[model samples]
Target: MSKLFTSYDLSGVMLSNRVVMAPMTRTRTPSNTANELTALYYAQRASAGLLITEGLPISEEGRGYLYTPGLYTDEHTHAWKEVTDAVHAKGGKIFAQLWHVGRMSHVSIQPGNQSPVSSGEVPATNTTVYAWTEDGKEGPVLPSVPRALRTDEVQRVTQDFVSSARRAIEAGFDGVELMAANAFVFDQFLSSSLNTRDDQYGGSIANRQRFMLETIDALAEAIGGERVGVRISPFGRLYDLQAFDGEEETWASVASALNERTLAYVHLNYQPTITAAEVPAGFGAAFRKAYRGTLIGAGGFTRELAEAELEKGDLDLFAFGTSYISNPDLVERMKNGWPLAEPDRSTFYGVIGAKGYTDYPVFDAGNESLKTVA
Candidate 1:
C-alpha cells in the first residue's frame, strides 16, 4: 500500500504529510484582518502538513478583492501573528500568499476608485473582478480602465513584494508564495496580450517575464530563496486570455526565464481554460529537470491521481484545494483509504462559521475501554 502519511522535508522544514492546504478566498474577515475565530479556523485544519493563506494584498492599492487579508499594515501583521501562533501551537506550518490584481480590480478596492495601477494602463480584455456586494457573492462587475504604470512605478511594485514578504515573515509565517499566477498584476506583465509596453517591461517574452522574475528575486533577497516559492499557471486563461496558448513555445520560455533563481518550489496550477484544448498540463516530468527545486502540481487532482503522479518521482508536493476544503482530515482519509464526505456546493463559500468549516468528524480507530491484553 502507498504511504500517503509519509513525511517530506522541504528546505529544512518537515511536513507531517504530503498534504498542503491550498489558498481559498474567504471574505468573512472583518476589517481585513484574521481574527481569533479565524485562528480557530486554521488551527482546526492543522492536521494538514502545511497551509497557504488566501491572497494577501501587498499595499492598500494592491487590494483587489474585498475582505481578503493584507500584510502591509502593522495592525494586519499582528493579527496574522495571532493566527500563525495558533498554528504553531499545533505544530503546523503556514505561508502567506502575496497578491496584486493589476487591472483586474476596481477603483473601489484601490485608493480613489482609479483603475488599478499596472505595467501599462491596458484594460484587461475579458475579465471582471469580484467585489463584496451587500448581499455577498454577486458582483463581478467590469472594472475601470487601469492606468499604465511608469517604469519607476513598475520597479516600486516589485520592491513592494519584498516589503510585504518581510512583513509576512515578521507576522510569523514560515514562508511566502508570490501570487504570480492567475490574472493578477504579475499576470498583467507576463501575458503578451495584456502588456503592450515598448519599454524594458514589455514586447518579447524576455521583456514580459522581467517584472515577474524581478519581483521573485526581490522577495528572495528579502526572504531566503529556500523560504520563497513562486506559483505560476503557465496557460492560465483568466482576464483577457489572448496569449492563453503559447503552445510549447510560451511555456518553455516561461520555464527558461525562471531558470536563474533557485526557487523553493514552482507550483503549476492546471485548470481547463478557454485557451487550450489539452487540460493544462502542469509541470510534470518535463519540468523536473528545468526547475532546480520541489515541483508542486495543483488545480484539479484527485488523491488517486496525485499518488500516481507522485510515484513518478517528478512531483515533490501536491496542493489539494476543494477536496481539502470539505475534508479537514484529508491526510487521515488518504492514510486509511477512508471514504470522504462530499462537500456541500451551497456551503462551500458559506458565511456561517464552523458549519461547513469544521463540522466534519474523524475516524474511530479503537475502543478506549480496552481489556488487559498485555
Candidate 2:
C-alpha cells in the first residue's frame, strides 16, 4: 500500500490515512451557524484521515466574509456538535480552523458597522471581501479601512482565540487548527509592509511574529498542545501582502519557533504552480529541517506529487481542498485510480441547497449505484 493510504499518528490521534480535507469556505451558513446540512457536508467527506473545517470566526469582530460560520456563541457550539458527531460516527477526526480576518473585512460585516481592527491602520487595497454590497445583497466589496489595535487590546484578541478553542472542545472537535495562513489576522501582523505599528507587535520580525506566537502559546495552555495545529503560508502574496525584507528569514524564524512547541503539526500552504518563483529555493526542505514535527503540505497536490514529497520526507500528510469538493470519496478514488469528478464553480459558494455541496456521489467501479450514503 502507498504511504498515503497507511495509518499514522497525528499527535495522539490515530488517523486511518495521511490524506486531509483542507478547509474551503463554502459560505452555506447565512445565519452564521452550522446546521444539519453542514453535518452532512463533512460526513460525506469523512473518508479522509482528518477533516479541517472552513474558517470559523472566533468572534463576530473576527469575521470578514458573509455566510461563514462563527465559533464564539453557545448556539454555535451546539450547532457544530452535530457535524462533529457525524464525522466521528464515520471514524474521522475533525479540527475546527479558528479565524480572525483582521483588516481584511468590510464595515458592514463588523459589529455596529465599526471598522475592522488590525496591527496597523491599513486597508487591503484591490482586494474585496465577500460582504453586503450597496444594494444590500451579498457580493464582493472593498474592505473598509481598519483601525490600529491598541497595544493593550492585542492580548484581548489572543483571549478571543483561547475562548473559541474552548468552545470547539465543547463542540466535540478532536482538535483545532489556527488560521494563521492566507492574509488573516496573524498574517496581517506577520507582513512587514502591512504592519507599521510602533508597539511591541511590529517593526522587527520578532515583534511582528509576537502576536501569533503568543496566541499559539495561549491556545496550547487552554487546550493541550497535542491537539493544536497551525497553518502558515510563507512568501504568500495573497490579499495585497507584499514580499518584504527578511521574508525568508522571517519564515525560517517561524519554523524554528514552532519547533520549540509540542503542537500536532505545521501545515504549510505552498503552491508551486503560483508561488514557485516567489518562494525561496529549497524552502520546503529548509522548513522540514527546521521543524522536525509532523508537517502537512497543501496547495494543488496530486497523489503522485504527494507521494514524491512523502518519499523525500518533506511532508507527513497531504491536504486536498478543491479535489474534495466534487470527490467526497477522494481517497478511495486515488487509491483505486478512478476517474475524478469536476466541481461546478458557480455553485461553489453562497448556495442554499445541497446542489453543489453534499450532492456529490461516490465513485462506483461496478456501476451498480451512484448515490452518496451520507
Candidate 3:
C-alpha cells in the first residue's frame, strides 16, 4: 500500500491522507477579502489531505501583490470564516499561510506611500511586484526602494505575526504556516547579502536567523506549537535573493533548531525549476536527517516521484500544486491513475469570475465523463 494514501497524525490533527495541496497564489480577491468565490474554490478541491491557503498578508504593509487576501482586522476574520466553514463541510483541513513581503513592495500599494521595510536599506533590483502601475492599471512594476527596520520595529513585526495567528484560529483555521520562503521578510533577514544590519538580527548566521526563530517562538506561545507549521526554501533565489556566505550552514542550523520543537511540520519548498538557486545534491536526505519531525516536500512533484520519496521515508507528506488547479479531484484521479486536464495559463490569476478558478470539472468515475461543479 502507498503511504501517500494512508492516514497520518499531524500533531493532534488527523489528516485523511498524505497528499497536500500546496499554496498557489490565484489573485482572485480584488477586495483583499475572502469571499463566496474563494470559499467555493477551496471547497471544490477539499479532497487533499491538507490545503494550505495562499499567502495571507498580516497587514496592508505586509502585502506585496494585489488581490491577495489579508488576515488581520475583524472584517478579514469574518470573511475567512466562510472559507474555513466551507472547507470543513467537506471534511478538508486547511492552514493559513501567513505572509509579509518585506522589501517587495511599491509606493502605490504601501500605506502612506512609505517605503517598504527590510533587514537593511537595500532594494530588490530587477524585481517586480504585482501592483498598480502609474496608469491606474494592475500589472507588474519595479519595487520601491526599502528602508532598514529599526531594532524595535523588528520585534513589532513578530507581534504582528502573533496577532495574525490568533485571528487565523478565530477565523477557524486548523493551523497556520509561516511564509518564510521566496525572499520574503524572513528570507530577506536570512540572506547575508541583503541583511546588513548590525543589530541582534544581522551579520552572523545565528543573528540573521534570530528574527525568524523569534517570530516562530512567539507564534508557538500564542497558539500551541503543534498548530504551527513553517515553509522554507533552502538556497532559494527568488526575488533577487543571492547566495550568501554560510548558506548551507544556515539551512542546517534551521533544520536542527526546528527539530528541537514539537511543531506540526516543516514544509520544504523544493522547486528547482522555479528558482534560479539549485538545491545541492542529496540536500533532501541531509535535511531529513536533521529534522526528525513530520516533513512535507512541495514543488514539481508527480505522483510517481511523491510515492518514491514517501516510500523511502524522505518525506512524510507530498504537496501537489499545478495539478490541483485543473483537477479538483486530484487525489482520486491519481489513486485511480486517471488522466489530468491542463490548466489555462492565462486564467491562472485575476478576479475573472471563475472562468478558470472554480469551473474546472471533476472526473465522474461512475460514467467516465467530466462534470462541472458550481
Candidate 4:
C-alpha cells in the first residue's frame, strides 16, 4: 500500500490518510455564516485525512472580504457546528483557520467605514481588497492606508486570537490553525520592513517575533498546545510585503520557537504570492530540521511530488488547493490513480450558488458525465 493511504496520529487525533484539503476561499457564504451548502460542500470532501477550512475572520475588524465567515458570534459558531457535524458524520477531521487581514482591508469592509489597523501606517501596494459599493455590489477596491496599532491595542488583538480559538473549539473543530502567513496581521508584525514601530513588538528579530510567539502562547493556554497549529510563509513578499535582511535567520528563529512549544504541526505555504516563484530548493529540508514537529507542505503539489517528499521524510502530510476545488474525492482519486478533473477557475471565487460549488462531479467508472451526491 502507498504510504499516502496509511493513517498518522496528529497529537491525539488519528488522520485516516496523509492527504490534506488545503483551505481555499470560495465566497459561497453571502451572510458570513455557514449554511446547508457549506455543510454539504465540506461533507463531500470528508475523505481527506485533514480538511482545513477557508480563512475565517476572528472579529468584524479582521474581515477583509465581503462573504467570508467569522467565529466571534453565536450565529457563526452555531453555523460552523453544522459543518463540523456533517464532516464528523462521515468520519472526517477538520481544523479551522483563523484570520485577520490587518492592513490588507478597505474602509468599505471596516466597521463604520473606519481605516484598517496594522503594525504601522503602511499601505499595501499592488494589491486590492474585495469591497462593496453603495448598492451592495462587490468589486475590487484599493486598500486604505492603515493606522499603526498602539502597544495596548496589540495586546487586545492577541486576546482576540485566543477568543477566536476558543470559539473554534466550541464550533466542534478538532483543532485550530492560526493564519500568520500571506502578509496578514501576524506577518505585518514579523516583517522588519512593515513593522517600523519602536516598541517591544518591533525591532530585532526577537522583538519582531514577540507578537506571534505571544499569540501562540495565548492560544496554547486557551486550547491545548497539542490542538494548535500555525501557518507561515518565511520568504513571502505577497501583498507588497518587502523583504528585509536576515530573511532566512528570521524564519529559522521562528521555527525554533515553535519547536519548543511542541504544537501539532507547522503548515508551510510555498506559494508566497499568486505570482511568486516556487520556494528555493532544499528550504523544506532546512525547515524540517529546525522544527522537530509534524510539517505539512502546501502549494501546487502533485501526487508524485507529495509522495517523494513523504518518502524522504520531509513532509508528514501534503495539502492540495486547486485540485480540491473541483475534485471532492481528491484523496480517493489520488489513491486509486484515477484521472483528476480540471477546476473551473472562473467559478473559483465570488459565486453565490452551487453551480461551481458543490456541483462538481466525482469520478465514475461507468460513465463520463459529472455526478454530484448533493
Q: Give the TM-score of candidate 1.
A: 0.90
Candidate 2: misplaced stretches above 4 Å? 273-277
How do all models score by TM-score? Answer: 0.90, 0.98, 0.98, 0.97
Deviating ranges (above 4 Å) for candidate 4: 134-136, 271-274, 277-281, 367-369
Q: List the residue pairs that clash in candidate 4.
A: none
C-alpha positional error of residue 46 in candidate 4 after TM-score superposition, expressed in Å: 0.4
lDDT values, one for every candidate: 0.76, 0.92, 0.92, 0.89
Which ranges in model 3 have alpha carbons more than 4 Å from their true place?
Answer: none
| Candidate 2 residue-wise lDDT at 52 | 99
**Which clashing pairs does model 2 show?**
none
Q: How far off is residue 75 in model 2, in Å? A: 0.3
Candidate 3 local lDDT, residue 219: 92
- Candidate 4, residues 1-374, lDDT tens digits: the string is 88988999999999999999988777778899889999999999999999999999999899988889888899999999999999999999999999999999988889999999998998997888888865777987888899999999999988999998999999999999999988899889888888989999888999999998999999999999899999988788778877776777888899899999969899998654465545667777888898989998987788998888888998898999889988999987888788899988999889898988899989876675557765
Per-residue lDDT of candidate 3, residues 10-53 (tens digit): 99899999999999999998889998999999999888999999
Ranking by lDDT: 2, 3, 4, 1
Clashes of 3: 0
